[model samples]
Target: MNDQRLRLDLAALADEVTAVDLRDRTLRTSRRLGIQRAVATSAAALVLIAAATGTAFAIRPDQTAPPLPADTPSVTATPTPNQSPTPTPSTSADDPSGAPPSGGSGTNTPSVQFGKLFYGPADVTRVKTAILRSWRPGGSTVQLLALPDIAFKGNMSVSSDGHRVAWVDSNNNLVVADADGSGKQQIRSNVDPYCVGAAWSPDRRQLLFRELAEPGGPGRFGMLDLRSAEMTVRWWASEPAACNAVWSADGRTIALTTDYGVTLYGADGTKKRVVPGFSRDGWSTDDVVSLAPNGSRVALLRRNMGGGDAGDVARDLRVNVVLDTRTGKQVTLPLGGRTLRQVYFQTDGSMVVRVQAGSGYAVLLVDEDGKKISETAEPASLKDMQILAVVD
Candidate 1:
């Protein structure tokens, strides 16, 4: 299980691995500029950090991440509903109770498309906006402001000096609530309905999550430790299953990409480095590793085919790999979009993902060898009043 190749220097083996290599050295290859592109994968040549000290995305081949010919947010426009999570600083909600966690306390909610706080990537000089939902237990700031239906799905994490913010609530629990939701608490709960978030710590305090239990089940998946207030698990199964998570940016190492591959968990939890094949349903470890505000490297969207010949999955998509979460090594982006439920990872590796198209998806922001930088169309009015709880 060894890809053999080695040079080892990922910032001295993941400490924020940096040697730098992204100053634009010339590119252009949607197939020799003939442009029939889409259906790609296969890459190498890593290390790049100097846009002062953080950045991603810059693929070329006449550059084409296409497919925004514009169908537009499906055109009905309706985010202005029952809104009021407190801070319209900007950002997400989805489930309004369909019956699930009966043990009760499920209060830290936010889903229904989800949003409670956002505004990430802060360090090149410190630019922030990180608030994101929290605060329920004693009532004075962990801010969960509304909590009724629960929202703020994924990506908006911060740590390398952006102040704080590490998401995931609704019923999946595992919160840190501050940087906006102010003082709210919990530190842990049932977790993983597909759980894919809660990463912050390289000094932001402590957080990282993942779980999948069954193989011999008794509970134990991968990295889990919030440090103070209470919660502490970090049990990377030698058995059971379900484990995919990431957290680096000084939170002290916690990378776990599994279905069975890719791992790194120190900060005192142990199990460092199992990563050889890495796959958590192909690519996407919850909130997708994408770190780098000084925590040093980890930007993965990954899933490529782009050498084409598989035809028709909606006109055949070809390439979209972007790994290097500390030397798994990869880089290629020229997509056509197919399944992608959500991606979001910016600071250069580039991405805003969620493409289903035609009848639904339209959130494009792809780049970093994948192209198509911004296509947002609509979904911003916030007027009604029932959005209930997204307070950052």
Candidate 2:
């Protein structure tokens, strides 16, 4: 009976040990599963946070995240409604007029057409050799001629059609040449060496110039027919300083500025009218005078001689006085307070003016009513240069 009891107890002990070992194994497996679930939950939470903040967390095929470019920022996949894409260049045809398209650079836009402007040295007295050049608006200057021993102390006159130019030479001879300095001709010799101005007729067939009876004597007006090569004395003036002949566009009237005032004469040398406010003694060396195409108005520089000695007087050189020959009253010009340097009347009764512009000069085209039409800045190389003629 004792032996049976022992065997039964041994069997019970073995069952108990087996049960404890199974429980221990179950606890270990539960703890291991709990740790895996916690790790997976944390990883999912991180991915969710990155998506909500618009930060991309890229995963590689190897289940690892690589570093992003330092310079690049995390961007959202969707764009706003107002966002515009970068524009690509177009290959369409350009404008037919060679003008830039709208919203293009204005620096490449075409400038206003001011025609060819003939100019020379500002101070000819200092240079023995000088060049005549032509400047077009928005174009480079081209040398037209090289003058040797230039005797004329004034501006040259270009024909209305821009075909010819006329000036006096060092030999006291009237020289006429093509606009390009070709086909030169000495039409008249032994003429007044100091005849500072000349004018071309409306037909471009006659030239009006000054003639002196003798050197250092009083001068008169002369007209030369280019076709016939005939010369005629048109008018006789009593003053020695009477010169600067300007013609009306119709070629019916002529105007001369004298020491006393401006004298208007018919084409037949008859006295038409005398507009008397100008004094040649007070005028500057480069003083320009122009007559209206209809012979109704005259423009000149007005000098204000202040109180002082003749040599020390302060002369104002800024005022431009345009007088109506019929009423002898000043016509107001819209100059915008810019100082006038020179003025020339166009064939259409408009005026081209050179005004002082901050150490350089600017050209302005104004209508008959003194309204600004267009303006262009002169090249810096033409500072203090003279506008001899405007070829339009």
- Pick by lDDT: which candidate is best? 2
Q: Tens-digit lDDT track for model 1 on 27-78?
A: 2222222212122342211110010111111110010122221112111211
lDDT string for model 2 (1-392, tens) is 88999999999888876433446555653432221111235653443222111100000000012222211222111111111111112211111222211211113212222445666665543465666666655555655655642322442566765556677664557788776667788887655533333467666777766663542332566677778836544454433354556666556566665444566776656677777554445432113256665667766655533311222111111227777766667876656687877666654456667778788887776666666666777777678556666644
Which candidate leads in TM-score? 2
Model 1 local distance difference test score: 0.33
- Which stretches of candidate 2 lie above 4 Å from their native place? 1-113, 148-152, 218-220, 229-241, 278-288, 305-319
Lowest lDDT block of 10, candidate 1:
44-53
TM-score of every model versus the real structure: 0.28, 0.62
